[model samples]
Target: MSTLQTSINGADSSVAVIIPSKPNPLTVTYKDLVTECSSFQHKLAAIGITNRSPVSIATVNSYEFIVSFLATSWQRGIAAPLNPAYKQDEFEFYIEDIKSAIVLVPKGAYDTDAPSVKAARKFNAAVAECYWDNVKKEVALDVKDLGQLKGHSKENILQAQPDDVALVLHTSGTTSRPKVVCHRSSQMSVIDVNVNELLC
Candidate 1:
């Protein structure tokens, strides 16, 4: 795996991240984040997700959602993050369009009003619920599966490259359907270079 070193709020740290997640209240190290991501990655794989397969993560600003997103990326799977405010019909369309293999719903959000849960049942996608208080235990159960994912080339997990589409933002359907935009990582690099040169 590749290692990345960066500073957060003036503190220098080295991180080996397969997926990215918010810091746990109890854990204070980059390793803790990586471990959490790894655990979620294992769980996804165990449930039969392969690289490039579509998976939807539904949550409301919780650590679980972040971990799930990172875990999907780590496994080289496509992540379709949806608005927690979506209704059943909207969710159905999005999930069907992406052909989501699974929908991850954080605990307390699985009630009838939860669009993800409703759509998951309609689309026959596998639904996995994550409880906030039980995150550690759930993560442990998937650790063994995550081990198999390590040691692979890091490049393989990336869904978008330097010149591929990075995000798919939907627009108003009444005026127009969702529009697709293409973005290149190189464009960011070029912008950075120009700004630095101007400053220098």
Candidate 2:
């Protein structure tokens, strides 16, 4: 019965994430994680991201990515994560196919005009830079363009339903275009059933 959002509500003081790659390892507790995710979720909903809205994430493994991914699902939106190393063509295919509402890139991506940013712009998908702001002590969402959401009214924060599609990914196709795979919100769980035994 637990959805991704419900499952994430862990002990407040427990460590949830640790990044040791930085000069100093950064640690985040469950309480901080929940607060950060809630803040980001509010930002998404305000921008008209609702159930089934696709939010493409094209950043490296980092705290910003994690927050955006979870927040997207929390808002009942689909989180389509693309490899940061993908080229513009690859990015375009995925972004276009998913019809992403917004694309989240790393800091300064808008200035450098990163491939992901260009692809998003080409598809008229909103583009934003997601990064950890040390000064603000939180993840920053720097929206460059509203794109499809221009003139869109703010949306209420939505709760995820068990049947909602929380994620959409593609299979690597050696022969043709990748196939789209949709993962339901209900699938984000801790249970693993023994199908073979049950069928017996």
Candidate 3:
């Protein structure tokens, strides 16, 4: 089972992702989160990121970041998360390296001086300003469909393969030029095994 399914099958009603903007805590169940993810998936389909092409998200800590990331994963897109603190040269190099199709930003966070935004524009990729609050309202997954999708949809859709590069963590070059280290999805198991042995 995918990580998403495991979370949903083991859901708690009181479980929630803390949204800092709201006065009161926004409570969302694992089931609800999955539904929201699916809805966002459909939204992406409507917007045209599918198995053929993928979208990339660029953000600092904002509710949009979580939603967009989940949505992209649900849509079987390659998610390239960039450091929100990257400088102009680093940002430009990373964007070019990943060949990102889109850059998702918060509703009003766009700055001409922002390195990621400028790099995104330079690459001729689309920039989407997502409103987390609005997305929560409009994009919600169907509760009944969740079980079915969880059981089969993930498998039927292309599961990111062992060789598929999940993310690129750019080295923070305090002394020299930044370079990237590609991380493949399958290597996670190896890391987990090694960590378990060390802990034990």
Candidate 2 Cα errors over 4 Å, as ranges = 191-200
Name the lDDT of candidate 3: 0.53
- Model 2 residue pairs with clashes: none
Model 3 alpha-carbon miss at residue 166, Å: 4.0
Residue-pair clashes per prediction, in order, are 0, 0, 1
**Whose TM-score is higher: candidate 1's or candidate 2's?**
2
State which candidate has the highest lDDT: 2
Quote each prediction's TM-score.
0.62, 0.92, 0.66
Which lDDT value does model 1 have at 147? 22
Model 1 lDDT vs. the true structure?
A: 0.52
Over the stretch 1-200, how does candidate 2's per-residue lDDT look in tens digits?
Answer: 66667766545677777766558877888778878989999999988899889999998888888788878988999999899889999999999998999999999989999999999999999999999999998998889999998888898988777888887889988899899999877786442121111112
Judging by TM-score against the true structure, name the best candidate.
2
> Which of the two candidates, 1 or 2, achieves a greater lDDT against the reference?
2
Report the lDDT of model 2 for residue 181. 94
lDDT of 1 at 24: 35
Residue 81 deviation, candidate 2, in Å? 0.3
TM-score, predicted candidate 1 vs. hidden true structure: 0.62
Provide the lDDT at 54 for model 2: 96
